[model samples]
Target: MFSKACEYGIRAAIYIGQQSAELGRRVGLRDVAAEIDSPEAFTAKVLQQLVRAGLLTSVKGPTGGFELTAQQLATVTLRQIVVAIDGGDMLQGCALGLPQCSAQQPCPLHYQFLPIRDQLNEVLRTHTIGELAGKVHDGLGFLKQFT
Candidate 1:
C-alpha cells in the first residue's frame, strides 16, 4: 500500500545496493532506472530524495553517478527508504484516507486492516536492503515483474 513513487524508490535503492554489493559497481541514473524498469525522470526525482536523505551518494560530472557504501547498502531498510521518500504518513495514515479513521470511531475495514498494516511495517522495518537484494541476486527471489 505504498505510492508508486515509493515503490520505485524502494526498488531503485535495492537495485543500487545490489549492484554495489554484487558487482562492486557504481550506478548512474539511467542505469538505475533501466534496471528497475522505472521512468528516467521519475526515477531521477526519487533518487534525489534518497540522496537528500543521505542514504545515497552521487557525483555530477562524467564518470559520475550514484553509489552507496557497503554499510549503507546493507543496512538501509525499506522502512527508511519509504519514509524518506513518502514520509511516515504513508504507513501510519488511515487506510481509507479518512481524517478520523481511528479505533474510537473506526472505518469499516479499520480493524481488519490494522494487523496487516502492522505486519507490513514490521517487514519493511526489519528487512535490510542488502538482505532483500541478496535474495534476488541468489535467485531465491526476484525484483523484475516479467523476467
Candidate 2:
C-alpha cells in the first residue's frame, strides 16, 4: 500500500496535471493543497522532493510556485513519486521483512502477492501523472454523483 505522503504526492501531482490541462498554466502549492485537501506543510515537503527529483518546476517570489516541466510532463511516472516519498525499496523489498527473502526463498505471501506486486509496479512505471489525470478527469463514477 501507499503511505500518506505517497498518497498526498499522487494527489498533488494529479491536481497540478488537472490545473495545467484546464487552465493551460502553472499552479501554486497553496492552491493545490487547498484543492486536494492535503496539509499545506506536508504537501510543501512532497513538492520539494518532486522538484528535486526533476518531476516538477518551482519558481520563487510573489508569483512563484510549482508546475511540472515539459520533460516531467512527458516522463515523470508515478513510480518516481512513490520512490521520492516512500523509496523504491518498499516495492522491491520483502513483504514479511525477511532479511534474505527473495524469489528463490519465498515469504509466506510471496507466491500469492508477488505477481500482483509486479503488475502494480509495472502500472506505476508505465504511466505518467498526465496519463493518470485522464483517468481522474473522467469523473469519479458514482462517487462524484453523491457530492
lDDT winner: 1
Each candidate structure's TM-score, on Cα atoms with residue i matched to residue i, is 0.91, 0.88
lDDT of 2 at 62: 80
What local lDDT does model 2 show for residue 114? 80
* Model 2 alpha-carbon miss at residue 78, Å: 0.6
Q: For residues 1-147, what per-residue lDDT tens digits would candidate 2 score against the true structure? A: 899888888888877876666566778877888877888999899889888887878888786777776556678899989998899877887778787787799889888878887888999999898777667777741111235
| Model 2 lowest lDDT segment of ten | 138-147
lDDT of 1 by residue, 30-115 (tens): 99898889999999999999999988888788877888788886678889998998899758777888888999989998999899
TM-score of predicted structure 2: 0.88
Question: How many residue pairs clash in all the candidates, one count each?
Answer: 0, 0
**Model 1 ranges off by over 4 Å:** none
The global C-alpha lDDT for each of the candidates, from Candidate 1 onward, is 0.86, 0.79
Relative to the unseen true structure, what is the C-alpha lDDT of residue 57 in candidate 2, on a scale of 0 to 100? 81
